[model samples]
Target: MPSESPCSGHADVEGKVGPESSGGPPTTLHSAPQNSPAMAQLLPSDVKMLLLMSRDPGRYSTVTRRLWGHIFDSLVVGSLERMALGVSQLMRPQALGPVIRATAMLYFHLCPRCTVQHYEAALDTFWRPPVKPPTLVFYSYDDPLCDTAHLQELLASWQQAGMPVWAQAWETSRHAAHLRQHPLEYRHALITFLGRLGLVAPTARL
Candidate 1:
C-alpha cells in the first residue's frame, strides 16, 4: 500500500477521486447515498474511502476482501513477531516495519458498532487540516459485537436534521454481504452514486 503526506488527509489508498489527489488505482468512493438530500439535491462531491465498517457475518464468508485482509494481517504480524529476539532475535529489524504498519491497520478493521471519546476540540485538531470524511454508509445487523441500533439512530439524526451531510443515505442497506446477496442491485446503486460525481463510466458497473 502506498502512503501519502499526512498533511494531505489522503494516504493515497486506491484513489477514488478527490482534491489535490494523484497516482493510484480507483478506490471505492465514499459519498452520498442515492437519495441523500445533500448529494441528491444539494452540492454533490466524491471522496476518498468511507470510514464505516460493514457487518453481516455473511461478508466474512462471501467478501474475499476482508478474509484476505485478515489473512494478510495475521501473516504480517506473525512474521514480524516471529523473528524479534535479542542477538539472533526472533524478528528481524526490517520485520519490525511491517509489524508497525499492521498495528496501525487496527483503525480500519473495526466492527460496524463502535464508539469514540467525545470530541471536545475548540480549534486545531491536527494543525494541518481536518480531512472531514464524507458521511459513511454503516451497515450492520443485530450482531452482538456492535451497536447497530445506535449507528442507525445516529445516521437517522444526521440525515433528518440535515447535516451538510458528509452525504445522506437513502434507505440504507446492511453491510458488505449486500453485495454478495444482491450483486446487480449493489452494482447499480454504487454506479449510480458515483456516476452522479462523474467518477465512473456512465454505463459501467460500480
Candidate 2:
C-alpha cells in the first residue's frame, strides 16, 4: 500500500476525488484493474507507466514532480515558475540521506504500479475553477513538450465549458521561459489579461 500524504489520506481511493475544499478543479480520476495483456495495445508505454504508478501511492515523491513538470513544460507557459513551485512543495529536509532519495526515485521509475495518483488528485483539487474570473492561457509553438493540436483542444474545451478564456500562442521561447524570453510581450499579455479581470487599470505598468 502507498503512504498517504501528511495532510490527508482520502485522496485517490477507488471512487473518491478528494476532500472538500475551496481549492481548484476536481481531478479526472483513472482506475487500473491489475495487469492486463490488453493494456499494452490500449496505451503507450509511457502512459502505462504513469497508470501503473497512479494505482500505488508509494511512488508519489519520485513521479509526481516529473509527470507534472512534463505536463507544465509542454504547455509552454510559466514552466520555470511551475518547477520552482513544485520543489518548494516537497519541503523535505536536506538532511534526509541521498541514498533514501535516490532509492525512492529509482523505485518510483521502475515500480510495477502507480502510487502517484493520490498526489495527482490532491494536487488537482488545489485549484478550483473560478466562478467568473477572466482567464488567459498562453502557449508557445517552440515548446517541444506540448502538442499544438492538444492545446487547441484543451482551449476549446474550456471555452465550451463557459470559461472566460483568452488563448495566445508564441512563435519562440524555451519551455516556461516566456517571461524571460519576451519580457515586454509577456508583461503586455499579463496587463491585458488582468485588465479584463478588472484587477488592474488598463494603463497600469508592472
Candidate 3:
C-alpha cells in the first residue's frame, strides 16, 4: 500500500476549476496506470530519469532551468490559485507532499490491472499553456543551455518588446537549480527582487 498525500485522503474528491470553488480542483490527479508499460515506451529514458529525479530532493538540480522556464499557465493559473488561496485550503508544505502522493495514486491506481488511460491523460496535459507573469527570470551568464544569445533574445523580447517579465543573470547555472546549489545567493536575489515589488518579507507562506 503506497502512502497517501494528506490532501488525498478523501473518498469523493472533485476539484473546482476556479477561485470561487467552495472546493479545490479535483483532489485527484487522474491518469493512466504506471505499470502499463506504455508510458515507458513513449517517454525516452533520459526524460523519464529527469522527471523521476525531480521527486527526489537530491536530484532536483540536475536538470537545467530552461526546462522549467516554459511552464506557468496550465498548472499555476487563476483558477487553481484562487482555490489554493481559499481560507480553508490546506497548509502549503504539509499538503504538498501528500498531494503529490495522492495524485500518483490517482494515476497508477490500476497498475496491477494493466491500464494506461490515466497515464496518457497526464501526458497530454503536462505542458503549461502560454501565459506570462510579472516574472523574474534568473539565468547564469555561462549556463550552457541558456547562454548569452538566449538571454539576449529574452531581454530584448521582455524589455524592449514590452513583454511582461523581468530577468537577472547570475554567474552560475542557477536557473531552477540555483536554489538547490547556492541557497544563500538564491535567497538574497529572490528577497531583493520581491522587495522591489513591495512584497518584502514573508506576507504568507508561499
Candidate 4:
C-alpha cells in the first residue's frame, strides 16, 4: 500500500510499497508502479529484486492523460446549488452513493493543480532510467483500474530496455487483490519467482 500522499512512501504491505528482508540481500516487493522510480533510488545497493502488481505508470502517454482529463471533467461538473441539493438529500439511503461521489468530485475539483503535479511526477518517474533489479509483474486483463493495453506496453518497454522482466496475466482479478482473489495461483507465481531469484528454497510451498 502507498501512503495517502503518493510522494511520501513506496508501495508495500505497510504504508510503503517495498518490504525488506533480513540477513541477506534485501528483496523489495512493489505493489504500485507510480512510486517505483523513487523506490529505486531508495533501494539498498544489494537489493536487486522487485515485484510489480497492477502497475499504474503515471499515465505517461499524452492520449491517456487527455482521456482521463476529459472523463474527469465530464464527471465533476455541476452547480453549487445542485451539489448542496445532492448533499442535503444524503439522509436518504438511495441518495448516499451519489452524495459520496459528489464529495469525492468536490475534493478533486479543489485539488486540480495538485493532481496535475502528481501526474507529471508520475510520468517523469516512469521514464527514469530503469532500475537494474530483476522484476516480476502481475496484472489482469479484466482489472477495471488498470488498462491492459497500457500494462502490456509497459512490459514491452521494460523488455526492450533490456531489463530482466517477467509478467503473469490473468483473465480476471481485482486490482491489487490478486493474492486474496486467487490465492493458490498467486502463491505459485510468487514462490516460483522467488525461487528463481534464490530468495526461497526450491522446496518452498505455500
Q: lDDT per residue, candidate 4, 1-206, as tens digits?
A: 32244432333323222322222334344433221112232221111111121233232122222211000000111233333343334334654756655664565467644333443344344444324356677777654334456556655776787766667668976544566788887778777777777777977997
lDDT of each: 0.29, 0.41, 0.34, 0.43
Note the clash tally of each candidate. Answer: 7, 18, 9, 7
User: Which pairs of residues have clashing backbones in candidate 3?
Assistant: 5-98, 14-26, 15-25, 15-26, 16-24, 31-118, 31-119, 32-118, 32-119
The deviation in Å at residue 173 for candidate 4 is 1.1
lDDT of 3 by residue, 9-72 (tens): 1112212111233332212111111211132322323323223333332333223222222211
Please list the residue runs of candidate 2 whose C-alpha ends up more than 4 Å from where it truly belongs after superposition: 1-132
The TM-score values for the models, in the order shown, are 0.32, 0.45, 0.34, 0.54
RMSD of each: 17.0, 14.2, 17.1, 12.7
- Strongest candidate by lDDT: 4
Q: What range of 10 consecutive residues in model 2 has the weakest lDDT sum?
A: 30-39
Best candidate according to TM-score: 4
Q: List, residue by residue over 114-200, the lDDT tens digit for candidate 2.
A: 423433342232132222224465667755434566567656765676656666568876544566777898778777766665556
Residue pairs in candidate 1 whose N, alpha carbon or C atoms collide under 3 angstroms: 83-90, 83-91, 84-90, 84-91, 85-89, 85-90, 135-166
What overall lDDT, based on C-alpha atoms, would model 2 receive against the true structure? 0.41
Q: Residue by residue across 1-206, what tens digits does model 1's lDDT show? A: 33323322334322332222433443443322222111111111222232101112221222212111000000001111221211122224655755544442342134111101101110112111123222334333422112445445544554565422222222444322345555675566555555554566889854
